[model samples]
Target: MPQSHPASVSSRRILVAVVPPVLAAAAVLATFLSVRDRLPDRMAVHIGGGGHADGFSGQGSFLATALGVLVGDGVLFGALASWIRTNPGVQRVIAVIGGAVAVLTGWLIVAVLLANTDVADASSVTLPGVRAALAFAAAALYAAVGWLVCGKAEEAETVSGPSAGAGRLPLGDFETAGWTRVTGSRVLPVTGALVAATGIVVGFTTGWLPALPLLITGVPMALLTGARVTADRRGITVTPSLAPWPRLNVPLERIAEAGHRTVNPVRDFGGWGYRARPGASGIVLRSGDAISARLTTGSEFVVTVDDAATAAALLNTLADRERRTAAGG
Candidate 1:
């Protein structure tokens, strides 16, 4: 007899995935209604409450916009969680990066659409608390979704094919530390630029001291944009010089360990891009997986990768060859 997968049996899995967006929609709708009554005297506004509003308050527009915001976000969060639960090896790469993108996209839409509207800031409505609640609730929903999705993905892939993930090669006996490789050189520059731009704006707004940190922080980030690993018959090479900023390099030989780690911003780290905890470090490389590696230098680096396990295996194989060569094997 065949075994039943958790996804097939657990109703909670579905509930966890479904609840957040539903709640979020309800909250936003409540906010919209509460604030609708408090429109600034000069600024004309309307709600389609009775089918008696114009363009700004058209019944269809309000409903459509609300659905777009709430349902869209809910769908994204739910789908990603589903993907993560169903896929683990892929989990090594997809969770964090994917989750962050989904989150940021959702938040960006919500913030931009609602920030200027009276509906977001009515005196009767404690907007901050509501916002906080939404954030917290969204996070909770993500966790439930991740648990269910991870389980489902793992189960589905088993029957599907050779998704063992990384094609790992054995390292000839040396203490190994887990490592993962990723590609987000694209993201590196973009993040650094945003950080730099933010610093510039804030510095000009406040004082130079606040912006000063950007100078230091920006250099490393800009440099990361140039840093990348490329594979050839010989092995992988680190190239940080390609970027316009300062650069760094590490041949495969110096690598002590590598592995793929999932960084679901919602589930694992709660957000995106470079989060560190008590014993682990992660980078939200993309939506799902991150490439993580620790070096003999006592520093661990993570980057976003499409396929973290494959990247790790490649590096591990190269590192092992270097060790064997040194041992005259």
Candidate 2:
């Protein structure tokens, strides 16, 4: 096994961590500056439940709100980076979630300002559905950027010396070892169902046209129904408990090696549930022990599960047997 180091924030990582928040701040600043002179002297800054502006503030107050959010977010994220430098994975998760929040907040502020501009009555202005759509879009865009920019950990070490008493299971003529477990968040599905239900209700109340944006929230909820993992002679397979048609099967023949490691779901895969990085993909239901298969195709696949060491040992043992059989040794 390769020696593990305590997580430390490198200079490069600090820079990467700050980029998203800074950009989000800049976006708000740019929008405010461009529209500052055009805004009404007393802008409608607050909306009532009836979908009309209920509170008014001077243009300066409106601009101050944007500045306040920017500064507050920057301080919060910077403090998080400095304090949690030791846990790179958790830090990365915070940075990404914070960035998304910053962008969406900025978008909301800017959208409200624009929507009220040149209006005859600020109080009568209602936030359009487009703003909600834009918020979701901004979140998706920042998430992708975060995934691309987040640093990659060094390749996990593999155990290759020998398995003297590795406890191998037999599969017909081939010796095999395997494990199965259910993985995912029990709370996620319920939350998704609730959101979908809310959207449906709102859609029906306001006309079916309002439900289109619900798809964004509904699809992910449906996908979070959980998954079942199985490993054996055929390699590793991840089947979604709700939908079995789209299973992930990694053939043993394609795997060059297998090993176990302690993993952070947020840091390593950005988050949980079938995450994909540049050269790696993981069925990470949660954080902690996991088995990683280094494939001949140069990609790494991981699954979080208990007793990962035994599963990895069996995988490596089976791979060796398959290789020897192929060579007719």
Task: For each candidate, give its TM-score against the true structure.
Answer: 0.39, 0.56
Score residue 86 of candidate 2 by CA lDDT: 50
Model 2 agreement with the true structure over 83-141: per-residue lDDT tens digits: 65555655666666666766766676777778777777777778767676787698779
State the lDDT of candidate 1 residue by residue for 26-55, as single tens digits.
Answer: 655665565545443222122122222222
Leading candidate by TM-score: 2
Assess each prediction's global lDDT (C-alpha) against the native: 0.48, 0.67
Off by over 4 Å in 2: 1-108, 114-120, 123-178, 186-225
Clashes of each: 31, 1
